[model samples]
Each structure stands twice: as structure tokens, then as C-alpha cells.
Target: MYSSGPKLYHVHNCDTRQILEDYFSGNQEMVFEEDFLKFPIRNCVTTFKLGHIKGDILIDLSISSMIHHLYAACEFFKHIIVLKVNDRCILELKRWVDTRTGAFHWGHVTKLHAEIDEKSYEFQDKEGKVRSAMQHVVKCNLEKENMTEPIDLPPADCIISAWLLDVICKDKDDYIKYLRKFLKLLKPGGHLILVGSLEVTYFKIHKEKFHCFTYDEKFVREVLVGEGFKIDNCNVSRRTVESDLIDHKGVIFIAAHKE
Candidate 1:
């Protein structure tokens, strides 16, 4: 059997409360919040083994604060292509990926901007370039727009998303319609790995209460099968506490292959 190397991770029943309780006592890697140790899932993609280490990723879209997911993808995939639909996350991911003076994505690779829009809003620090370029992201995205298309780079081996499918199709019926647009971006036989939260992230900013929903793993499978993607694997990270550091706590992880 080929062993999962020390770099790869597989944490079953992975919960935050239990991990955090352990962390507060001493450890630093794990944390707790939604009130439990194991977290919950909406849907799950199968397990993905790094068959070939090619480092290109696409994140679909993200908010300014969700840049961490991009970093995590870089760390998890070994090689990644982070596709950002939002101006803020793209700016932050590019400005901070390297130079060793900014917020590093997941402690591994720092994504440098292959290209950035010159017309987007930009902010510099009154404190004289504080932390790093990513610190200026909030200022940059205020006027950001999706006026351009992502240039076609060399083929990528994997694609990833976090909590995106939940928003695509809430009732399962509309899921495929929303997802078909994204599937066209992937190269055939490439993989799509996703990790998403089960909680609403807007409680702190909006005047609305959020609803809890499952990602409908069955629907995810149906959509993938219909799209001609070969089944690879699927798994869920248990329900756990949400984090104020980022946003929600409950999460799910899934991996699939394109045929």
C-alpha cells in the first residue's frame, strides 16, 4: 500500500471544540467554537491523492477575508491554481503570497500576482506600509470589478472550492444549473476538491438571520456523474464550532475527478 506521507492529513471525526479544549491547555494548532469537537457536513467530495504535483489552483470566487482558504488550498494541494472571482481575495492572495513580510497563506507557498488590474481600488497604509500588501486589500476591493476574464494558463491537475456549492443550488434542482458554468473551466480528468462551512458567515455584518442547510451530497454526486466526471471519493469533516477568526465553524470536505 502506498502510504499517505507525513505531509498529507486525514483527520476523521475532526472536531474543533475537542481540539480547542486540547489547544487551550497547551497545543497551538487546533481550536474550538461551535460548541463541539467534530464538525458537520453539507456534502462531501471523495479523498484526493496527489497523483501529480502540479501547482495551479482556482478558487472560483471569494471575499476579502476568505483569503485563508486560498492559502489552505496551496498547503493541501502541494501544487495549486487559486482562481479568485472577487477582487479583494485576489489582491490579498497575490500581494501576500510571498516576500515573507505579509500574511502567508497556510504557511506554505505565497501566491504572487501573475497579473492584477490597474483600475481596482487601492489603499496604502497611514502607518507606512503596515504588515504587508494584503493589509491594503479592504481598500482595494471597494471598487473591484469582474470586468476581465482569467487568462488560460497551462492545464491544472486539481481545482478546489469551499462552501461554494451550498450557494449554487439550495434545493438540489438548481444546483446543476449553477455548477455547469463552473465545470467548463476544468480540464478533463482534473480533480475538484472542496471544503465548505455549514454555518452562515454573515451574522456579524448583515441585518439578517441565516438558515442552516445541507449541501446535498447526493445532488453533488448526481451533478458530477451527469457532467461526465468519474467518481473518485467523498468524505465529511464532522460538525464543530465556528470561528470568529474567519467565519462559520461547521464544515465539509469533498474531492472528485473529471473524466
Candidate 2:
């Protein structure tokens, strides 16, 4: 495991899943013959249609988490729009896609991604083969400059506000208002995915400041439920790269449907 003193509020760098596996096993339910994380039903993902129904939009709001979430979405939907709320995460996610370069398996993700498009398997470059119909990934500045809160967004089919809400203060009533703005970006009967750690997250500014709202289960539930999102599945777990030797309870995933 890992050890840290109060001086080092966190015991890790970004790659903490390894050391964490030994320390924060905290109530993680393991119910499969093999590791259950690879199983779709075991992971609590919603099975729904994600392709265009003449008017469906997919928003990956958490710039960083969008990488994997988008990686998953790419198998089914095309013409997706992503919001670049956090440049750090967005850039990193883009880098991951560049590095992995069509490493996703359509056959593997098909059981899950195919609910959106029957041709989900066709989006792959797997088996050393690459398909040419490209998917778009870009940045949307919800708010920039001196503004503390973002502008309202139009509705869509699916929205994933990754790492976007991890900065609001517990007292910012604007937090709820901004969340509604995020929700309104989704059309009725659409889906949204909130991704981040549900616990405390720290960032080093000139000094150190607690992001306070970088990601949380309770905070997301309050905002989404208030904004009329129906909770589908709530998942809290970490991706363990044992080689990294760290664990993080920070990255939580919430998938909900708009009411």
C-alpha cells in the first residue's frame, strides 16, 4: 500500500490505483468468477439506444473522462459534441486517444455499444483494419474569461459532465442553477453521464486549494435530480493499473436519464 503524512494531504500522483487496491478496498463488491469490472452488467451501465433518432446529441462534458466515455460512445454514435470545461483533462484525453489509436475492440464493446447502432462494429480499426467515417472531438467553452459560472447550453440526447462540477462551493446556490443549465443541454428522455471522484479532490494552485466540487456523488445527485434527471445507475470504482501501484476512489460515474 501507500503511506502519507498530513503534510502530504494525498498519498499519490495521478497513478494511484495500484497502491489503493490494498488500502481503500472500502466496501467494493466483487461478485464474479473472474474480475467483474470487465463485465457490463456487473459495472451497472444502462442499455439504451444512443444513435441519432433524427435529433440525438451526445455531450461529453468532463473533458478528461470523455476519453474513455467517448471511446465507449464512438462505438455507437457519430457526430458527438464535447465540452471543454477543463483543458487539462481534455488535452490529456486527446493524448490518450492519439496514443491508443483505434485500440478499442468492436466485438468486445459491441454487446454494449451496439444498442445505439447496429453498425457499431463497423466503426472499428480493429483486426489491423481502419474505417474512414470519422467522429468529431473538440472543445466547448461553456464559460471563459472572468466568469465564474458558464452560460446555458441547448438540449441534446446524452450529456457527460466530466470534472465540470468539482469546483463549485457547497454554498454556491449558483451551483444548482448552473447544473440546470447543464441538464437543459439534454433533450427530454436523453441520457447524461457525470464522472469524477465523489470524495475530496485537491489541486495545487499558487498554493493548494480544495476543488470542493471537482466530482462527487451527493453533489451530482442533488443537481441532476433537481434538474430533472432520473438516476439509472450509480457506479463508484477505480480503474486499477496494478503496475501503477495506486488506487483512487475519486473517479465516480453517474449515468442518468432526463425526465
Candidate 3:
């Protein structure tokens, strides 16, 4: 059965600082070391540096303060449109971008990316790049016909959706429908960088348990291929840490291009 709990991205349900310290900083016991430490930071940075994904417009369909992916995207894209699920997430992100007090610090993530890129002291540069590249923070509804409704955004050259579909989708068909909705925001031949929690049926945020759609790597690849995307790179990392925080076996990262 689907969860009737509070939405995961709701301000009260989600703690930006806690999430960064726990999951993104390699401190969460339920998150695998490689999954948090290397899979996202290293792979994304290296892929962007390879110059294979250069573009002018990029759309981010994940949480607002996803600095790990934004750091890489800033280097390649001139304009970034961050499509959020609600005002809470957008407000949190805006605080950071505006350098407001009490804004969640993402120095840990930026430092990690800098270290992996062998530019250990360039965290500030990465932050500036991301801040400069970011153009807008708008609300999006995955279940709606026009995901970014009331705001007709231009087609993007690339879309980065990380660990969002699994949490919001109720089933495999819903996941596929959302994937297609995301594709509609991208230009033909635009790239889709997708990150997912493998076999994760549910996760918790403090006291609330949020539902997630569980699926294997094969299913992910098949759905993307069936939607007219050509898989370019696919990486999976097994879980090494176990805790009551979340239920999952691994994480999957896929970089594909729409055909």
C-alpha cells in the first residue's frame, strides 16, 4: 500500500542539514560508502569534465540543494533551471543561493567534489560556478500533464533527476509516466542523468515513513530504452551499511541520451 504520510520534501518532514550530514557526508549507516562517497561525486564530475555532455540549458528535477550534481552541471551548462516539488524546497535552496543566514551549508559536498577532481582547494570556485549558472527555481508536479505548469520553460539540453522518481512514484507504471514527463522537458537528443535507489520500497525522514517504488537495474534500463533513450553509462553500487534509516540494497546511476 502507498504511504499516507507527509511528503518527504515538506519542510517539517525534511531536514536539509541533517540529510547532508547523514547521507551526503558519508555518515549515514544505511548508505553504502561508495554510493555516497564515490558514485555520485566522482562519476558525475569525471563525466562532465570529459566534455561529452556540454549544453546551454540544463534542467534539474530533484531536490533544490543537490550541490553534488550541480557542481558538475555548472561547469558545462550556462543556464540551469531547478524544478522543485514545493515551496519549502525552493525556499531552502533560495536561502543558500542568496547567502542568507541559517541556510544549509553544502561545504562538505563541495569539498568532496573538489577532492575527487584533484582540485582540493577549489570548493569556492565550484560554488560560484553553480550559483552563477543557476537561472531559476520553479515548482514542478510530476503527476501533472505539464510538469512545470504555469511556467512554460524552454526545452533543456540536459535533465538531472536524482533519487526522486522512486520516492514519488507509487508503481512501475507511474515511474515510467514520470520519466516520460521529464523527457518532455528535454530537447530531442538531450541527455537524461538519472539516479535511483535500487530495490528501495520505503525510507524515513525523522518519524515519518515515505514510500518508494522498488525495482532492479534491469527494469530501469528497460524502461528508459523503451522510452526511446539510448543508455550511455550505467553504474550500480551495492550497499555496505545497514540501518533502520532506509530499506534498499544498492543505488543505480544512468546517463542516457534521448534518441
Candidate 4:
């Protein structure tokens, strides 16, 4: 069993399966289904359908092994490149991509995606499309100048980062620094879609609590604008679900294009 103390996410042993069980698995908790799954997926569908986020290459930098966030993306972009910070997350994601035995099932969220996008008839093919578009799941080291060193990547037309900055950043400055890293990866005027938790300090997987950086919507906007991003759309939703696993006040989604 894990301890009760709040553990730093990066330094601790973060079990990908435990994360799936505690957060993404709708059977265990319904709150994340709204905040993490539905909210981001809805925003993605809307943003991608706006006819401006178009691009050939899309990069994903997300917090967990979850791919529900990419269901809407596959239809819009031809190439999807996933960059993971840890080996575990890379392996976990590849398991799903390769359809390995005992891979975590994401069918429920795919159904949710179909329902939200009103494409229920094509539900059978959604997973395949996502799998086809996602060509590479590469490991990234945020500390390096070239996150995906040794294998130089082409500038992306768009990037979708879900709940990653909030988990990896230690403070407000760290957040800005990391945002700069993402900015460097995009081509000029490339779009960025950010999905994050607002006012959340920590979350628990099982018995071990993981640190989460707390920030408000205003800070996020200010940082983005200060870094030369033009906000195209912003959506924020207050949390209505009650759960002790996480203490987030709300969730925020922003679609911005770099100037």
C-alpha cells in the first residue's frame, strides 16, 4: 500500500495502471469523465472544426497514458506525434497503440467521443483512425534543449498539451519556462491547445498523493499572451462533482495561435 503523504509525481513511482484506475476509469470515478475526458474532447472537436487549426503535423504532450484527448484530433490532422516525458507512459501508450494483450481498454471513452461529436454511426472506426494517425510515440526529456534529441523533429503545425504543464511545473516561473519550450517546437503561427486543471494543489492515485501546481485562468492567459500567443478561444467550466481524489476547483481549455 502507498503512504498518505503527498508525493512528488516525477520522483515517485507513478503507476500507470493505478493512474488509469483512479482517474480515467469511469467505473471508479465519474468526475474525471467530465473534467478530463468530456471537457477536453468537446473543446478539441469545437476547436478543430473552426477551420483554422488545420495542419499536417500535430504533436501531443499530455500528463498520462490517456489517448481519449486525441479522438477528435485524428480526423483533423494527418500525422499525430505523441511525446511522453517518461518511459512508463511511452510504453503504456504503445501498448494501446499496438493492441497488446491486457492493454487498458479505452472503448468507453471512444463511445463518449462518438456521442459528443455526433458520429455514433462511425464509432467502430474511431479507434482505428486514431491509431492510424498516431504514427510515433517518442520519449522526451524536458531538461534537454532538444526534447526529442538525436531525432530532430519537424516543426509541428499544432500542439495539444493536456494537464502536463500543471503536473510538471513547480511554480509560476517554471510554467512560463516550459511554455517557452513548447513554443519553440511549433512553426511560426502554429496553434496550441491547452487543457488544464485550475486551482488544484494535489491528487491521489491510490494511497499516495501527487503534487499538482495550482494556477488560475487569469495567470494562464497572461502567460500565453506574454509569450506571443493570440488567444482564439477560451473555455472554463466550474467543477460540479464532489470527490476526494482531486481537489480541483475548475477546468480550463484554451486554443491559441502563435503570432
lDDT of each: 0.38, 0.45, 0.78, 0.87
List candidate 1 segments past 4 Å from native.
1-79, 98-150, 153-155, 167-174, 198-214, 242-250
Per-residue lDDT over 1-259 for candidate 3, one digit per residue giving the tens place of the 0 to 100 score: 3245535443235665555555665444525446755677777876788788978899988743566777878888889999888677788788888889987767767777788888876866778788888858888876679877778989999999988787778778888887888888999888989887899877766656667788999999999899889998998988867866678899888999988
Q: TM-score winner between 1 and 3, please give it.
A: 3
Q: Per-prediction TM-score, please? A: 0.51, 0.53, 0.90, 0.95
Ranking by TM-score: 4, 3, 2, 1
lDDT of 4: 0.87
Model 4, range 95-145, lDDT digits (tens) per residue? 999999988899988899889999899899999999999979999889888
- After superposing candidate 3, which stretches have Cα over 4 Å from the reference? 1-18, 25-33
The number of clashing residue pairs in each candidate reads: 32, 21, 0, 0
- Per-candidate RMSD vs. true structure? 14.4, 8.7, 2.6, 2.3
Q: After superposition, how far is residue 259 of candidate 1 from its true place, in Å?
A: 2.3
Off by over 4 Å in 4: 1-5, 28-30
TM-score: model 3 vs. ground truth: 0.90
Candidate 3 accuracy as lDDT: 0.78
Better lDDT candidate (2, 3): 3
lDDT, candidate 1, 69-152, per-residue tens: 332233234334444434444444455555345533332111111111121122222111222212222211111232123344
Better of 1 and 4 by TM-score: 4
The candidate maximizing TM-score is 4
- Which window of 10 residues has the lowest lDDT sum in candidate 4? 1-10
